[model samples]
Target: MTLFTVDPATVTPAPFTDDDWAFTLLRCLASPSTEEYPPARLCGFLFLAPDRLRLYFGTEPDLPGTTAADVRPGGALTALLAALPSLLDEQRLTKTDTDDPHCSRVVDLTGW
Candidate 1:
């Protein structure tokens, strides 16, 4: 797993794991704070690229909770979340943080 670093010493860094990212994504999705993030919605779609990950929701499919009735077939992100916890490549989980305006913290788990 990779390690996350916070600007403030009081904040604990998140251990690099798919589960960690998934949880972060989940919390971000459920929150109403948009100032820190770019223009996007929670249900629109997820953009997972080599350099960045962003979730947008505008006319996009909303992610139902695991108990919801309309869960995606194969559980989509849910299934991914489950599978991600077991990822073996520890080095790949590294978090590359940058001051770039486009993406501040990008986790590149491409090969894994």
Candidate 2:
């Protein structure tokens, strides 16, 4: 299985809140496409974490290299939040006492 890990250090959590983080991956899943990304479909996970995440992507043929950067959050989560309410169940975040990590539900998007 391919692995796409997202370290909290990579994401500057200065904008959104921990509660609203779940929405980020959903955003990515809905419209996860950058200039370099191929027009392939994206489907993955919304793994919760107090800090980082692992966005697993299953790319189709003609596309080989898929990474965490390929996943989207804002738009994807919005759409999903509206549809899959059950996915938003409350879960304790994995916060480290040392540096108060951005406690939030993480999404691991795969294939977009």
Candidate 3:
């Protein structure tokens, strides 16, 4: 068998306050199939901010869309690690990136 290793620089380091959002997202992407929800195949990108956390998945994911209540059971990762259950519960299921909200401003905390 061949072995491969990941370079540290390519990874997004977890913030000190929480365990690790990246790992949590990975787990959600690998969830096992269940009666209500099928196994997660492809996990969409993660958009994180102080006040909001959003997950975007396309229709090809084999998951249902947002319900009439404008709420759906978000991936387990957001619920478990985010801690802001209500705010993080909403996800944008879209197939195209054109509809995604553009980042007008970004703060660099790398030096902090």
Candidate 4:
């Protein structure tokens, strides 16, 4: 996997606090699907620091033998967000697993 760092200021809106930025990112990552765009299957995310976050995308569900692709260089947070849904729609990223908790547990962050 390719590791990179991004300044939170570039991706977040005004008020730029760490919690707010994280929330904004999570919301974007978990945005609902539309006819033109599919939902982003978020494997996970971690705040490495107040300014840095790491996001993981799951492997393509149809092609379990292939390694998951890395997020392309989008330069800004909005660009990254725009790219994600298409990636899932195109089968470059996995679909969200809504069944079979025994295979994997899904964490619901809405309550938090």
**Whole-model lDDT values for every prediction:** 0.38, 0.40, 0.35, 0.48
Predicted structure with the largest TM-score when compared to the true one = 4
Candidate 3 — which residues are off by over 4 angstroms?
Answer: 1-16, 31-41, 60-112
Q: Per-residue lDDT tens digits of candidate 1, residues 1-112?
A: 9998867978887756654555565674557454664223344324343333443233112222211111111224544444432331223453335443343233333442
> Which should have the higher lDDT, number 1 or number 2?
2
| CA error at residue 20 for candidate 3, angstroms | 1.1
Q: What does the lDDT come to for candidate 3?
A: 0.35
Clashes of 3: 0
In angstroms, what RMSD does candidate 3 have relative to the true structure?
12.0
State the displacement of the C-alpha of residue 4, model 2, in Å, after optimal TM-score superposition: 47
Residue 103's C-alpha lDDT in candidate 3?
A: 24
> Model 2 segments beyond 4 Å from truth?
1-15, 32-40, 46-48, 63-112
Residue 72 lDDT (model 1): 18
In candidate 1, which residue pairs get closer than 3 Å at backbone N, Cα or C atoms, i.e. clash?
Answer: 2-16, 41-57, 44-57
After best superposition, candidate 3 residue 74: deviation in angstroms?
12
lDDT of 2 by residue, 10-105 (tens): 887776764466555546555655555534334444343543344433344533433222123333555543433222221232112322122223
Winner by TM-score between candidate 3 and candidate 1: 3
Candidate with the greatest lDDT versus the true structure? 4
Native-to-model Cα distance after best TM-score fit, residue 77 in candidate 1, in Å: 18
Per-model TM-score, in order, reads 0.25, 0.31, 0.29, 0.43
Cα misplacement distance, residue 85 of candidate 2 (Å): 28
Residue pairs clashing in model 4 are none
Candidate that beats the other on lDDT, 1 or 4, i.e. the better one:
4
